[model samples]
Target chain A: MPKAELLDPQGQAVQSAMGRLGFSGVVSVRQGKRFEIEVEGQITEERRIELEHLAETLLANPVIENHTLTIE
Target chain B: MPKAELLDPQGQAVQSAMGRLGFSGVVSVRQGKRFEIEVEGQITEERRIELEHLAETLLANPVIENHTLTIE
Candidate 1:
């Protein structure tokens, strides 16, 4: 998701829409990106490390976003 | 995320880029949208149900995406 301190226009837009639709329980929203990656064969320790590195460097913008990787 | 049977051009593009970047462990990638929502006060059982309804009707595109909600 965008940094906590950053203004998320998209999220704000959704929140506004929700309010218009009468879902008042929602206080705020933050939109984020998700990726489900497939790797052939077993995910060994080395592969896990590589995947984390790739996710940080290529999939997510570290400067503006925080990312997490999970094995199914 | 887009349905598994559906083609995700964005994911395909990313996979191709990964190949070019020499991250061969990646077999495929499926990109999806995420949202972090905050609610004022504690989440009661009724609120949980309402949140689930809201997520299905407003937050996710049920036709092409599946969504899961968790209380973090």
Candidate 2:
């Protein structure tokens, strides 16, 4: 699984989004280190790019969010 | 000098406390990482203890706060 850690500078909105996505209680945003998501590996580079797009567009804020992905 | 980074799980109070203490905008509680304080070297261990006490009691939330001190 690849682990994605999303850091949100603006907490409330991120929390709201998580809630909207039905990931409310599962996600924790403390400090700048907000949500940590573990996703399955994709078969192709295109899929990886798609995953990244999903994370950036839907899971995190592009303006104030920072992310680190670790393949484990 | 010693650098103390205080992380507050509850952002509003930390911001309030820092504001009350005149720390105000210097403190940033984004996500969970809050204020960063830099203190001068103490002459004795007693002084170090005193400093720690001040930090824990006043600067952070003992219930949910986390801090790291670095002497530099």
Give DockQ for candidates 1 onward, in order.
Answer: 0.75, 0.04
User: Residue A66 deviation, candidate 1, in Å?
Assistant: 1.1
**Cα TM-score of candidate 1:** 0.90
lDDT of 2: 0.43
* Tens digits of per-residue lDDT for model 2, B1-72: 012254434444434544565332322333333332323444367655654664475444676656554333
Model 1 C-alpha lDDT per residue in residues B22-47, reported as the tens digit of each score:
77867789999999999888998998
Worst 10 residues of 1 chain B by lDDT: B19-28
lDDT for B72 in candidate 1 is 78
Mind giving the per-residue lDDT tens digits that candidate 1 earns over A1-72? 898988999999989988888778677899999988898889889988888898889889999998988997
Find the candidate with the highest lDDT and give its number: 1
Off by over 4 Å in 1: none
Q: How high is the lDDT of residue B11 in model 1?
A: 95
